[model samples]
Target: MTATQSGPRISTEDFRFAFRSHPAGVAIVTADAGDGPVAMTVSSVASVSIDPPTLMFSASAGSSSTPTIRSAETLVVHLLAADHVELAKLGARRGAERFGDDVHWGRLPTGEPFYPDANWLRGRVIRRLDVEGATIIVVEAVEARPRDDGMSVDPTPLAYHNRHWHVLTDRSMLPPAVAPFYAVYGRE
Candidate 1:
């Protein structure tokens, strides 16, 4: 039999450091409590199934938006574009300042808050898994709206890696039709 070896168990810091090397798309998850709107930035939003049009994302329990999200029947997920770096940073901040007057947002017909200019998906909670100080929420999409400008996907999606924001650029790797959406956005 071949020898089997085990490496030393990694600490939490090491786990985080390893995760930092991978890049993830940034999204703003928003829900409306009876009072107003609550939001948080997450990089974990991912598609779970296409047949049913479902998606999932995890949120820390410490986030003020968590309770609201758990209580709400539906939530809006905004896939941010490269130009929306400020919005992501704003949502990452704690407190009422996130939905302040400075941010441009609106409520959907169903009352979920959304960014009119950004691509969004509205989903109804189908399953919620509670895991150590966090919740893993799974939702089945009920509505989806692409950017008003008719872009299928933002060519330059705002990504988070190594604890910093980044814009991925590799035209050769993109499909011909998807190439046009990566237009230079402001400072990018």
Candidate 2:
């Protein structure tokens, strides 16, 4: 146990271990704040609302791109599929040249840098909250662009768990188990 200003808190190692056991969808967030484009892979992206088309993700202070992403007013969130595992790894690698000559990326008409290979959403940062050492960004999506290859149907989603990347496939899915209350309410 660790003591914080408020009260006893879980050890950092314990907190990390708990979260590491949980799987999360992978996304690469890109932004350009005049100097140049910066990209970082994140597993914290989550949908917050549908009516307002809002989403949120947390950027760790340790990431090299966190400052750029925090300062940029607009950004592109690439919802990576299993085919984008390499891209995910590239962005996650510390001190890696994300936009080097070999990498294929382009700027959206709206001016934010984006990876054309993955499905992406262009949005403006609506809110920024600094919690602990991480910055939590809330974006209101205005435009979405799917991949040009038309592979949208049932694309295998990329996920991160226990410090490893995994692809969610049909074979990995378990049979549906409905709760009694939900089943009585006609919910699947």
Model 1 lDDT tens row, 44-92: 9999999899999998999988999888889999888888888899889
Alpha-carbon shift of residue 135 in model 1 (angstroms):
0.3
Q: What stretches of model 1 exceed 4 Å from their correct place? A: 1-9, 146-154, 171-188
Model 2 — which ten-residue stretch has the worst lDDT? 174-183
**Which residue pairs in candidate 2 collide?**
none
Worst lDDT 10-window in candidate 1: 179-188
lDDT of 2 by residue, 160-187 (tens): 9999999999789765663366577887
Error of 2 at 172 (Å): 1.0
Candidates in order, TM-scores: namely 0.82, 0.91
Choose the strongest candidate by TM-score.
2
Q: What is the lDDT of residue 7 in candidate 2?
A: 90
